[model samples]
Target chain A: MSRLNIAPTKSNQLNLKRSLKMTSEGFALLEQKREILVMELMRLLDRVKVVQQELAQRRHKAYATLRKAASHNGYYHMRNIANGINYEHDVHSDTRVVAGIRIPTLSVKQGAFRSQYGFADTDSLVDQTMIDFLALLESAGKLAELETAVWLLARELKKTQRRVNALEHIFIPNYKDTLRYIGEVLEGKDLDSFFTMKMVKKRLAEAAEAAEAAEQAQLSDGDAPDTTP
Target chain B: MGFHIIGDADTVLGYRFAGLSGDVVETAEEARVAFKAAIANHRKGVLLITEAVEDMLADDVTAHRLSSKPPYLAVMQDIWGPRGKRRSLQELIYEAVGIRIVQDN
Candidate 1:
């Protein structure tokens, strides 16, 4: 009744079959992609955990050291020296692809160590705390990288899942139904052709039987002398 | 390009010695206000927040930290000492990655 069934031809059915095969293949590829992305996300998540732990440990250590520096040198004196020193951290990122998702890869570089203040002004504890903070900053850079990668891959995973669902739930089954419908229509046409041929053969046979009977009656009447009106 | 420090008066004052100037939020509402200002800052590349202020603005800080690209947020322990339970970061990690961790004493 609809254009979908209008053509019910072998070629059309073959075309649909090919399309179904292609869609199935595409669904499989997408599923594989999703699996790979999920794996990468998990690995990155583990890396992030390790980095977080390191960051926290370094933070507490740094704060403790800073506290020691403050107590040993007096708060005002420590602040005075801290205000004078400057440390610059540089960061740049490049894109890394995981399962076809581009995620950023960040690299942090801290400038050369410079204690602008006189060596006697800041205690060794203060110097140690600054180094620890630098370490914490480096770890923070790593966290940012992993977090971004995990989130980006997770986003791609969601998209791949949606496509897989559509192919599995809707497209494949609908194509199957159309294939069945077309097959039924084709079989019905074949049956109609067989019935038409049978009717035509039966009519021809009846006509030939009538001709033979007429010919036999003429022959018998001629041989037996005339009979009846 | 630089860092912003947000904490109580003492923490802010201490970090200012390191030349980090930021909002001093002593209350939850003030924490939210300070977070908005800190996030809107394009010049600052990192936010140094005292753990106490961070705990007060827990939900807001988490939202902003995850959503923003720059001004990488680093929660630092207050020189005064940690306040409350110190599981905020751990809990956030669990939420993000669903990993259950065992802390060593």
Candidate 2:
């Protein structure tokens, strides 16, 4: 019956050491990537805040203008006028890839509001109001487009950040420690072998010297044994 | 669960999800209708909206926020021009973590 042995060979030891070094190097690179990503994320966030505030103000102004227009014409009349106006709607959709992320795009046709009544009969104020409303709508549309981009980017950034953190704090450190442990163990084994070889050589030299001294004493005794002979 | 997306015609087209109901609302009234429908459906986990549409229906958005059954609403900006002006998850982190760093400068 053969018993199982579980000792790592020289080649396995070398490979382990190499792997550990590679993991540590990889971890260092990953750390740098994480830092850069975090910085980018921060900047993007600051811009988002600024944009959010601007959007809020713009929306408020647009709403105020719309409300004033509605009051002047009466809500029902304004609705009727808007209903009579012809608007042509067209939309185009596309996709763009950014940093391995696929983002959708839309191209919308800007609607032109044309009055059913003749321009001559229509009040200039109503026409101006319509134009203002359209402008506001366009602004709102643009803001929506911007917001969509911001939100999607934010989501992606968050996911990337999480991954970076995991690599930095957990995986890299564990691999590095394991590598260090293996190296230390190998170094210790080398030192122990060197000490054992020196001790063995010293013991053999002492034994040889003792044997020579004893041989010389015996030979001298034999040479001086003439009376006994 | 039903999801309603409100935005510009362009925005609505961009966010076409399989099970989501979408409305390309230019006016406040249409925005209101979409908002009501979103609230009624209650099954939507997320309400993806454009800032432009949110502007038109700020009041409705606020009302949804105050409601008990409000879904997770994510507002984003359009990415079209050079600057890439929009909201992102990174922005949320800055808001949540309160750490601000400027990388562009």
Candidate 3:
């Protein structure tokens, strides 16, 4: 692996070690986050599948019933009845946080159902169309919620995966290489200084021993001369 | 926060009867404008677009779908029913997650 362009020093080694530790921890956390996001995404995907199927069925039934109603009451008559409808329900939009994502949710506050149309004008076909469409709307709302959650979770998962890859493949390895390089350089410096110190100490001891030997010989020569005289 | 719709006349009117507000767009440009305005409103939590209008502004819809932002959009069939085969759950999951999920049943 290519090492980072850093000076191989003891202080740099310390810093690299700290950073490597932190990066490994961050990678683990991101990995966990990715797993959670995937799980959440899968759950939402399953729900979306169920909701989509239900929505398709409801859409077909609702539109078919609407076509029949339009044919029976006439298109203009159906439009008029729809315009005259005063029975409106409240849809409350709120958010639920899943894995730190704010997933929007829609709920219809069901109120008392009142027949706003006059019995003399509209037929039961109009009534059936209204019921079918209402059901369709409910399913559509649910599908929207699940699909949004899935999209958001998937996006977060992709981002987390990128970060994890960078740390696992690049950042952490670079730090480790730098640390090892610095460690080897420091050890080599220590070995060089130790050898030089040992040589200097040995040379000083040898020189001192030679000087003592010369002084002793000189004293012995002076004593021999005094005795001969 | 509230839910909104952008679609044709009958789809908009049908949802309006259910007490939801909507914008009825006749063309691609109109659909694009309505979608832009709808997403601009942070209070809009859900946007239900008819499949026909979605076809008109497919790029914009796909962009918003990938953005993972607020005002989630769901395309539904108009009163006449879906024009063509809508994307299956597997296809949608692949688009969102980039993984092909094999359906067991």
Candidate 4:
């Protein structure tokens, strides 16, 4: 891994160490969040699969009944009957948060079917189609809730994964490399200074000894001259 | 928040019979426009789209699905039938989690 382009200094090393600690902690937390998000996503996906299957079956049956109604009553007549339906159902949406993700839940309040069209004009098939489709509306709402939850959780999981990867692969490694580089540089500087101090001390000691020897030699020579006098 | 729909004519009429309000869109461009308009409505709690419309605007629909926004979008089968083959649950999971989970069942 490449080291950061920072001066190899004590302060820089300390800062890198601190940030590395923080990044690793964040990476751990993000990994935990990712796990939770994945679990939530899987659960939601499972529910979605079941609800989708149920909705598909319901829709198929409803459409089959609709096709039968249209064939029996003629397309234009069926369309008119459909237009005559006045039932108004209220769909309520509620949201709950999971790991900061808002998952929406939808509920359909089915009202009692009021037959607005005349009984003399339409067959029982039209009523059946209406009932089937109405039932489908509720299932559709459920499937919507599950599928949307799955999508939201999945998206969040992806984002968290990205952060975790960046920290583990890029950020943490870079900090370690820079810290090691700074440490090696500092240690090498200390060794070089210690060797230079040792060399200077030995040279100073040799000079002091030579000056003492020269002074003794001069004093001895003067004593010999006094004796001669 | 109320429920809204964007789909083909027959699907819209069917939902209309159930008393839910929706827009009938025929082409991909119209569906895209209708989808944008429907999402822009803050009062719309859930936006239902037929599978056919979803196929027409797959990218937009997926983008909305992954976005942390409301109204929530749900794709349902139209009167015609299921659109060919859809992405399996496994594929969806892999796309999101970046791992393939072997089903125990």
Candidate 5:
């Protein structure tokens, strides 16, 4: 493992341990953030699915009605209808943040689609078709909001995943290795000094014992009688 | 703000009856400029871009989808619209152009 290039000193050891602790804590915080974001994303995914299904049905109806209108009268008449009548829908939107990402909330507010084509000349089917399209427009607003929300959440989810991966796979592992290397070196020095102290103490004890024995032998042998006389 | 219609003259005209104000552009380049102006305009609440121009300026439209602010882009689809159930090129062209070019003998 590639350890950080630095002196293997006690201060270095302390520094490494401190940094390792901080990194691990940071990693934990990020992991939590990722988990929360993922949960939020899954919830939003469910919403998107439901709205999408509804939107599909509405869209089918809209297109079907449009085709009916075209066939019932004439393509020109259908074109004139759009050219004759106008429907202005006001959309009120706001933003709310989820996991630090801002998403839009939309509501379509419209009263009715007015007809400029005279009621005297048009068939009721044409009016019904117009109504269907207006309803589709309202649903389309919800579809847009939901779809946009999913996009924003999905993008944020990708970013959170990247951060989590960096901490788990790269930074955390590197710090752990550096801390382990420093710990091993410090332990090796401690063992070495321990053995050296043991050896010095043993040698000093043996020298004292030998001196005591020599004094005892001289006294016992009465070598040169007592110097008191 | 006002919605934008960036497509053929007819599609833009269809929206005009609704009293909705928008731009009718011929080229994708012009549409892009018009789209930018619409997004920047504070009064623009919703944009009703037709499917034709939306297809041409796909990237710009997608980028606009990510915008957190106002002027929500809504791609309006008429009777003849893009993107639906699959059809062979021959069938697609026949349906779009209504010309019986490909005849099975």
Candidate 6:
């Protein structure tokens, strides 16, 4: 079998070493990225779960209040009361950024509660009820928005999680295994070449010793006449 | 092309997407066909393929890494269980951002 020459030139060896180092660095970076994504995802998930639970509760309370008011005050009266409640001075909204995600902040204007039905003599149940209902409705809307946000965020989190897992478990491992294989092959070649060189040197030495011995034997065989003289 | 789901018969049927069809793609050949069709439709922005299908079509997926069009394929672990705790996405994030964010729980 023709022996394979495995001694790469200095430049090629340098390139290979550099590539191996680069691959290692790349793997490290991928690992770090996975960690960051997971942490962020987990944090967001916690917030999402809390919001989800709170939203559900708020929705339940709002439905219950609406039901109670309807049963006691009648649907027509509730509608009229809702119309007579002036929210023009009460509702407010603002925006804030959280981890690059924009979310709206809602607040109710203080001291703006008043009845449009001129029920000053009797406490205006309609006005109070309408305000409460509107507040609940606002909370419900916010909850719906939060639900959507949570679902979308969860989907994104899951996607990122999979990607991280892929790099960590599959891509990096495969690349590393291939690199190790190449390294082993190269090392094996080096050892084989070293052994071949050692054998060739030993053979050359043996050949020289044989040549010297043959010369000495020839001289001994021809020296009989010289010894008699 | 719209989003399509591929997995075991039961798994595929469990996925619900409006107007999207989920089909059980058992072999590499079937996955390749479905993947190509999803790409051709031009309307699909994402293709969620099962991890099993992904493993079968690994070569095909790698071959198309240079494409810049839509139908960005994403592999999901089987809903039944994870194949394994593969590389965390945190690693990819670190690759992009150069910081460790996912810590031990």
Off by over 4 Å in 4: A221-224, A227-229, B88-90, B101-105
DockQ for each model: 0.18, 0.09, 0.44, 0.57, 0.16, 0.03
| Model 3: per-residue Cα lDDT over B7-80, one tens digit each | 99877866765556789999899999999999997354678898899889989887898776767777777876
DockQ (C-alpha) of model 3? 0.44
lDDT of each: 0.70, 0.55, 0.77, 0.80, 0.68, 0.51
Compose the digit string of candidate 5's lDDT tens values, residues A1-229: 6667888889987887888788788888877876776676656656656765666677677667656666787877766666666655677788888767888888767756766678876787677777775666566567667656666666666677788788788877877788788788889999999999999899888888888898988886676567645
Q: What is the lDDT of residue A140 in candidate 3?
A: 77
Candidate 2 vs candidate 5: which has greater TM-score?
5
Give the chain B TM-score for each candidate: 0.78, 0.63, 0.84, 0.82, 0.69, 0.70
Stretches of candidate 3 exceeding 4 Å from the true structure:
A111-113, A206-229, B17-19, B40-45, B55-72, B79-98, B102-105
A1-229 in candidate 1: lDDT tens per residue?
A: 2224447888989999998899999989988987787667667667767887887787677667777877898888876776676655565656667776666676666655555678866678777766766666666567656655554555566678789889888888878888889889989999999999999999889888888888888788786675543
Could you tell me every candidate's TM-score relative to the true structure?
A: 0.65, 0.53, 0.83, 0.91, 0.72, 0.43
Using TM-score, rank the candidates from best to worst.
4, 3, 5, 1, 2, 6
What count of clashes does model 6 give? Answer: 25
Q: Which stretches of candidate 2 lie over 4 Å from their true place?
A: A1-58, A84-86, A91-97, A104-108, A116-126, A199-229, B1-93, B96-98, B101-105
Tens digits of per-residue lDDT for model 4, A130-149: 88878788787787777777
**By lDDT: ranked, best first:** 4, 3, 1, 5, 2, 6
Q: 2 or 4, which is superior by lDDT? A: 4
| Pairwise TM-score winner, candidates 3 and 4 | 4
Q: What is the CAPRI rating of model 2's predicted complex? A: incorrect
Tens-place lDDT digits, model 5, residues B1-105:
434455666555444434456587879889888888887873436677777777778898878776655677666654355556433222322332224565589
DockQ score of candidate 5? Answer: 0.16
Locate the minimum summed-lDDT window of 10 residues in model 3 chain A: A105-114
In candidate 6 the C-alpha lDDT for residue A222 amounts to 85
**Candidate 1: global Cα-lDDT?**
0.70
- Using DockQ as the yardstick, the better of models 5 and 6 is 5
Sort candidate 6 into its docking category: incorrect
